[model samples]
Target: MNLNKYPVTELSGNGKLVYGCDYNPEQWSREVWQEDVQLMKQAGVNLVAINIFGWAELESSPGNYSFERLDEILDLLHEHGIGVNLGTGTSSTPAWLTTLHPEILPQSADGVRAWPGGRQAWCSSSPVYREHALRLVEQVSRRYGAHPAVRLWHVSNELGCHNALCYCDVSASAFRGWLRNRYETLDALNAAWGTTFWSQRYSGWDQVLPPRTTISAYNPTQVLDFHRFSSDELLGYYSAEAEILRQHSTVPVTTNFMITAHIRTQDYWSWAPHMDVIANDHYLDHRLEAPTIELAFAADATRGLAQGSPWLLMEHSTSAVNWQPRNIAKAPGEMIRNSLAHLARGADGLCFFQWRASVQGSEKFHSAMLPHAGTDSRVWKEVVELGGILERLTEVGGSTVTAEAALVFSWEAWWAYDRESHPSSDIAYLDQVHAAYKALWEAGITVDIVAPGADLSAYKLAVVPGLYLVRDSDAAALADYVAGGGHALVTFFSGIVDENEKVRTGGYPGAYRELLGIRTEEFLPLAPGDTPPLDNGTAASLWSEALRLEGAEAMVSFTGGHLAGTAAVTRNRHGAGTAWYLGTALEPAALRETLTQAAAGAGITVASTPEGLETVVRSNGDRSYVFLINHSHEEHKHAIQGQELVVGEEVADVVVVPAGAVRVVRTSTPAHPTNGLPTGSKDVESD
Candidate 1:
């Protein structure tokens, strides 16, 4: 995708920051709809997403439809000058359809069909489900294809959210078909899956299944392939709907992506090309010890999924969410800080899950633009205030955030790394990535989460954390990137397996061994509570590799344990660039200090930031917009000089960023200049 052509300003026709929420007028009466829009306008909502869950209301029966309610809603929104992100209402199959064809319902891994009391009950691979879904999409697109108020076409609400993987017979048949196309022969499939291990070799394509519940653990390779198949199945459904929507409408089409790195079911790097606008639905993960750090990581990952083009914050919370074991409300100004955090990364649109709180649904407790307390609530006041803030910071739209460092995030690697029977089950792929990303985020350095195959030429440094499954092409690309003077940090457990989950021959980290200039004798995985001593009073846990340097210099080594005196970390000078290999997961403090030194070695500048303050700069050529966010309770003062765009104040030398507050400054300094870097380069550059 040519990112330059699809900048945020051009994607949003009016160049205004889109501020709105998922507006479900079907939940209310026509009399209440008027009041909803009046309140929406009062909150400065210019865009309203509608028809998300109206499939039952849209089609009461097969081949029978009703557009009366939808027509009234659209007319009201148009009259009020609010644009519409029209949804196809295909997320949930109607009760009538499911009642008639129960076969459309997705079957669980244990072979029980799902009941239809909730949404997304249909099987993605079922032809019957796709037939009806495409039909509904066509009808809705034809009805509002050229409507003046319709600005964007939302294909489906959170595709593959509930039924990402279905183990029904229909899905099994589809999985076999997908495998046939991929391997082309049963013999190749057996070879790739290493079926010879347990005398379990497939002779015919029909013998293949969807990795159902097994006696022992399912074959890791089979499970991995099934995961790929399931993801592609959902992507196929989305493409089918998008194709039909495109035939009837010329407006941009998108589907909200649940882009949390921990959710490894969907490969958004593959899905990004299909979307006209990359829209993500992010919820703060309260389960994490540091939810704010995870939020920033998700935002950066979402922006990178757009390939640095402008994307949308399609759904977030104004306050507490109904889900999660312990539903916690946002503290004062936390919501504003969260929204600004995404905006600082690269979101052009700020939207939420709902406009009004549901009065009688499972999500009744879910916060919205207008809470259950009505317009007099504190949540409502914050929503209105945020809307005003977005209006004033409209110029931040269409800007791009440049990063001197890039982190390679691979979904394929995540699947393989997180599989059972690993060296250590505690080594999570995203947790390691988040640890590295959080270190950089705290240093006030912007980092782009790019794919393995993405162009790395613009980045001075790249970090790959626990890339267990390394494709030959991807490895070659990274090798060339480092050879061209791009600095990289390759972590433990990387380069161990191939795309087929087969261990590479010769040595560990097979493809990168030469470029990284290190040979691993064996993996010394630590137990759950074990911590091995390392240099500089830092410890290593979870994973450790016994490394032997070939042409690399040991940067850090083990001081205790069986692998004492072995290299824990090494740096290799390869061609014009440098490659740093971390053989073990270091302690947090050590990891931070090591990364700081590595980044400086790569000529990447890290801002001197306070402990809880985050600084991000989004640039458009020569002009830069700096976002200073204080995430701590203590106040922070940064020496900054620019025009404060949020409150329209002129900032001289020092600016005080209050606790839980954000300040956006427009300055004339260029964030990053080419400086002899090749144009349209795909890999990293060196000094």
Candidate 2:
């Protein structure tokens, strides 16, 4: 297996580390740059992300360009021995371009045009926008083509803010072209969109307009279509800019993907194939304990794009983020613990959001290594300590890890449920997904959060919770996996819709009804304590489907309600294995029980019983690293048989660690020292 599939950088043979943080020298003078490099060396920081917001500095006018400032920054970094990921500086449109072509600005869903001020505001479908953006990329690549400090290329800033689809004429034309390319005939388009309703039939491709009031009223289908269009449109921007970089430079190219933030838009799976390396930012204000699962899932998602290659943990906060409702500092060692946790999950490198904290502007308050108070702060000290430990270790980067199970995350499913104007507005898609992840995590399963098309043949079990939108390809893949003797678990609202957010025509659970052995006749949406009038008091919610069994048997049913007698759970034999389908939203406890039962059917076993003590095993060939983290607030007892934790050599029945603590153990046969070197420490160089 390729160690690159595991997330780590090769600084030297048998000695490596994931690259370091994003360093911005634009805010400081040349004098400060020298000191910053000195501090970075002390911190063992080897990589720096630069030129992220330097578009204005790079190009003052449409044709005129300036590289003196960037040249100095790049040259100085190389001189000081720092590796840099050169940014194309196209994330935020330059003031001059936005001024000349106001149409370049993004238009919101309600058709409100966004004014310049924030990043990711460019109209993706605009030809003028693409031309200037690509030009800037070409100039940047050509000027820094062979720079020693430039190791990788970051195409643009976060793709989150672009909002993809615009109501502008340009976007409308692009959408029409996209639709035509997707479906050559008008009949195919009408059938795909179910335009038979509301007399929305099209005579020709020209009739297709921007998905807004101009073409259609507040139609959910249009809203969802616009989202898909916009995401693809922005992907075009990334692809265009990346193509220029790839042509000019040999360095791997990537953009910081904010997956969790854009749950409603920016489809990473569709754009993943284009990125040479996957990098993403992970920041969560609430549910701090469970956020690591999200990070692991994001890495898994990016790995899906990279064909199972490990992803870079690009922009996690060292402490608290200013964006959260409450900017709470990562308690004590939680920051470092979380950083290592990313590696445990399959992150190749570790980097924070900002290097030096800002004193002014929007991100001034965002957490960083050197806060506004300079190097005397706790954050800097924490970074230095972590850096010291990294300098001493060699096995952290490019090391292999392995997992036997995977979680199937579908953005198409997420979008389907998110866009639905459900009877109860509280039918949360994220909550359910998270809840399932929490259960699997608590069960001590080494889970790789992946998209639908990911290979499940190697995995003993694939869990699909709330898979509302089941693309035909995905359904076939899952069906084949189960038929091949692999176990599959699917929940309510799943297999009901296609990729375009259109409901499947034949019965409930749509395409996979046969595999699942159940067919839904009607949906029963219940309130928060009112569950189908069943005295069983089983917690169920917003939407419940009354299913009819075909070749399967029911596991549970509503004690009362119009559809009380319908099968709530069914199991069907498909191929050499089985498919379990849930017909309603089961309460967390019940879901956990069901998961335990299903996992048992698939031959999965938990390592420990404590909550928040998560473990992920990643292997490369003959070696494996087991990451055991206790993320709870209290100390816990934990033990696993036949594996030795390399952090502190001790074989025992139980181990104790403080809250929010983490440890990495080496568990290879003929156990070698965790560090490759017998004498000296690892040499960390800034890239």
Best by TM-score: 1
Q: Rate the local accuracy (lDDT) of all candidates.
A: 0.84, 0.71
Specify the poorest-scoring 10-residue window by lDDT in model 1.
678-687
What TM-score would candidate 1 get against the native? Answer: 0.96
Error of 2 at 514 (Å): 1.0
TM-score of each: 0.96, 0.91
Model 2 quality (TM-score):
0.91
Candidate with top lDDT is 1
At residue 517, candidate 1 shows an lDDT of 97
For model 2, residues 1-687, the per-residue Cα lDDT tens digits are 122432347421124565477777888888988888888777778788899988888888877998898898888777777788888988888777888889988776467898988776777788998888888889999888787788778888877545545777788889888878878899988887778888888998788876665443445565667677778888887888877887877777878887773345787778776766777777754645456677656565566555556677778888888876778777888887877777776676778878888777888889897777778878888888777555543454555445556788866667667754554566767767777777776665556667886788877778888787777988899988999999888877777778766778778878788788778877776666776633345756556776788888877776676776777766788888988887777766677777777777777653334666666665655555556677778775544323344345553433455577765555443212321211111111100
**lDDT tens per residue, model 1, 72-181:** 89999999988898999999988899999999999988998999999899999999988888888889988889998888888888888898989999999999999999
